[model samples]
Target: MTVVSHREDRVQAARSQSSPARSRSRTGSWRPASGHVFVSGYVVLLALFGLVPALYSLYLAFTDASGKFSGVKNFTRSAKDYRFIPAVQHVAVYLVLWLVTLTIFVVLLALVVHRLTSRRTKAVLRFVYYVPGALAGASSVLLWLFVLDPAVSPVSKLLRWTGNDNFAQVIVPNHLPAVFTIIAFWTGAGGWIVVLYGALNTIPTELMEAARVDGANAVQTALRIQLPMLRKWIAYMLILSLAAGTQLFVEPQLVSQASFGIVGNDYSVNQLAYQYAFSQNDFNGSAAISIDLLIVALICAGFFVARGRLFETD
Candidate 1:
């Protein structure tokens, strides 16, 4: 009986030690498998929707109507189109205006929101900010058309005061850059403000407190401490904004239709590409326009990634 009891004790001790090892192994194995499952799905989607289309665009850009490689002919052909330079100029002006507005206002609003001590107030304000962004792009643009028109708009007095007594006057070509910038900002900046506010939350409270202890005022602290920490977030916003701005299709296209071609069919690079493909039946030219925009986007993204040290660990 004594011998049997001792053997049972030894077995129990061994089981206790091995159980933890088995649990650890199970945990480690499950984690990697779960991670792989999530990542594999994303990778598959990106390859299918993002990578494949880009590669096909590249092929189309370099090939002729006969599917033979035509070198840079398609590129030069698109560039020589009469409307090309104007579209480029319009896009340039809009980008410059929109990017500058986004940088200043988004960051400023975010800083103001972050300064609020009441959690409920912050939550409500964040929701309010994001509400405009919830509207579809076309819907937002259409909504703004009414707002910009003095005839049927609630802000008719304000529109008239600005010398835009009619929709035509409001949407004139010279005013289109500012008009587009306002539309883009109204729909886009809200979401970015919410994003920047969230980024501000990720900053450690201890650092903020330390800054306060050193007699740093709100403006000083934001400029010296918080803004510096938010460099990467701002860079990311700029990169994405630049990409979306360069592909400015929906606003100008819809506006052109609404204004009876006052804004023109080729008001943006993407619109020019659309006109090339469907209107002119020039697929290679359309692809070349798309490739040009893609190259610009890639270069801007690379610049931000490098200058912002986006991947570096804190």
Candidate 2:
């Protein structure tokens, strides 16, 4: 009876020791269906809204007015339009100005905000930065029109200082790129600043402390540690900004209408596409133009992803 009791005690101890290991292994291996359930809605929405439209547009781009496969005829036709190249050029110039300004300023502002030690100050500043993002889309553009109007604008003197004595002068073809850049930055930069600031907060305090111990100054720490850590976030910002810049429609379109054709109907590729579809009744040409923009966006995204190693788990 004593020998049997000793064997049972040993077996029970063994089971107790192995039970935790078994539980941990099961926990690690047992991925729940919840993740798939959560993602299903997004996948459905994407398919319904994004995939469907993109596929239809792709089909339209390759077909003629009569619905027969026309190869690249629609693309060639859109390219041959007099307004196409110039619209593309305008969008290109605006994108360059907008992207450079956005990158420099958003990163700088985010860094500055992140350096604030007081939680209240950080929160207040973040709220202030995000305030402009609330006025997005057409309303933001209209608000800018009012702000840029030298005649009644509160910054009229500043505009006068820059030789822009009226809204017309402010939005002149020669200055439209800068004007659009400013508007875009005002409406867009705030959100990105908040995003980057949040990303900066994710950096471990221990790493920062180590940097300090190693005699790295603020600038060195930022450049070497923080910025490198933020590579994926910055890449995401640039990709989205590039995509938005290529679309360049609402602001220029509203400015054109407000300025009574001064900005022209075909100020950007999207506007040109709109003209093709509505004014010229050329859906194929419009789809072709859209495909061009889509290609540019995809190429830009690919470049950023490659350079930033965005998909790498490490």
Candidate 3:
């Protein structure tokens, strides 16, 4: 009896000692992990903001003008829409210009700004470059309006110098691709410069010195060492820029508005979607067009995701 009692007492003591630890693991560790609440909140917000709208849009895309299930009719109609192909082509042209300019010029400009000046001057120039990007959205559009207005623009002399006698010449249909490219570069390249410049900074000074010792000139070092190091950032920029370029709404819409539809009746797929949903009240058509854009963006994003090793650092 004494032995049994001793064993039971020991068992009880072990259970008692372990209970608090179990409780702590269950309730304490879960009290809050770092970023747990933030991540959870983001998930909730995404559900509310992203998932719900997507589901609703999906539902709408398959429905008719009468809110009845019309199968793929809406999508077919969207494909056959008069403005559809033109909108797609417009967006394609804009993206080509915007993405190419951003990729080449942002990197080149960052390299130039980083190498050509003292630290103070470089910092000042970076601030100036970043200002337009900081003022993106409606404000940037308004600013570009001033810049492109041949009457009062600081570049009026240059525009006249280039034989762009009026705003019409500045934003003609054939020249729109170039014009939007210039505007996009002006507003968008700044943020990217900041990113590339920061990436350049992360390149160890030792690497540059080693390149010098190996008789690599500035151009060679930038092209070989610096450029190679910037590959990941450039790829990331490509993916994001492609996605953003695909959604070419704000610039086109505002410019169209500013130009009083002389720019176009429809400038992009996104504009078509917006007009369908908001103006024409053809929600199904809008959803269908939006799905097309979503697919294109997903393809670009998928490439980025597939090349995951680009993001890794030793």
Candidate 4:
């Protein structure tokens, strides 16, 4: 009996140790459950919004306006359409003009504003600059249309240099794109200037002091010390501006309206897509065009991501 009791006690002690081991194993397993829940929620949201819509758009691009499957017929038709090449070229030119001009102007303006102002003054200036960004799309375009009117414009003398009699005549068909680009920059640069200023503020004050101590002039300090530190922010701004440039509908569309027949109705890729979908009643072709623009935007975004210099590091 004594031997049997001793054996039973040993067995119980072993079971106690095994119970704690099992409990720890269960606890380890439970920790991953929260991780799984987070991952599952993310996947669900992606499918519901991002992936599903993208797949639907892809499917639509291969179909007719009547919802009948047409394979690549719509895409091929769009490619061979008369307006396709011209529209592509126009967008290429617009993108170049908008992106390059806006970047240079915004960066320079932001740098100047940051350098020559007190904090309170800079904030107020930033607010004033960003006010144009608050204008609704239609309002901004309308305002520019009036600003471009030669008879009423305060800058009539400058417009006369372009050999334009009136605003309408001044912005000839060929010059319309550049005119619209300038208008866009005037309203849009302010917001980007603020963005760049924010990035500029993040640079270490010690570095600026050190540069000053080394007898570096203001321009030298800005070019060598400040600008290099802003490379990532500049890259981000460029990528975003490139994306926005591809969606150049408002400027061209509004200008087309304001200029009557002076500017072509379908002067941009987005306008062309709208013409296809709405006027031509060809949803598939429009989808194809939209998908093409999406691809371009994706390529620009990918370039930024691959460079590993877009987002903030610290």
Which pairs in model 4 have colliding backbones?
none
**lDDT of all predictions:** 0.92, 0.91, 0.85, 0.82
User: For all candidates, what are the clash counts?
Assistant: 0, 0, 0, 0
- lDDT of residue 238 for candidate 3: 86
Among the numbered candidates, top lDDT falls to 1
Can you write out model 3's per-residue Cα lDDT over 1-314, one digit (the tens) per residue?
A: 99999999999888868786665767666453657866998899999998998888888899887789999988899999899999999989888888877888899999998786588989888999988887757788788778888898998999999998888778777777887788788888988998999999899989888998999988998999999788888888888888888888887888888776688757889989998989898889999898888888888777865563465774
Candidate 3 minimal-lDDT segment of 10 residues: 305-314
TM-score of each: 0.90, 0.92, 0.83, 0.79
Query: Residue 294 in model 2: shift from native, Å?
Result: 0.7
| Regions more than 4 Å wrong, model 3 | 1-32, 66-68, 305-314
Give lDDT tens digits, candidate 4, residues 17-38. Answer: 8788566666785344667887
The true-versus-predicted C-alpha distance at residue 87 of model 2, in Å, is 0.8
- Candidate 2 regions with alpha-carbon error over 4 angstroms: 1-29
- Which 10-residue span in candidate 1 carries the lowest summed lDDT? 23-32
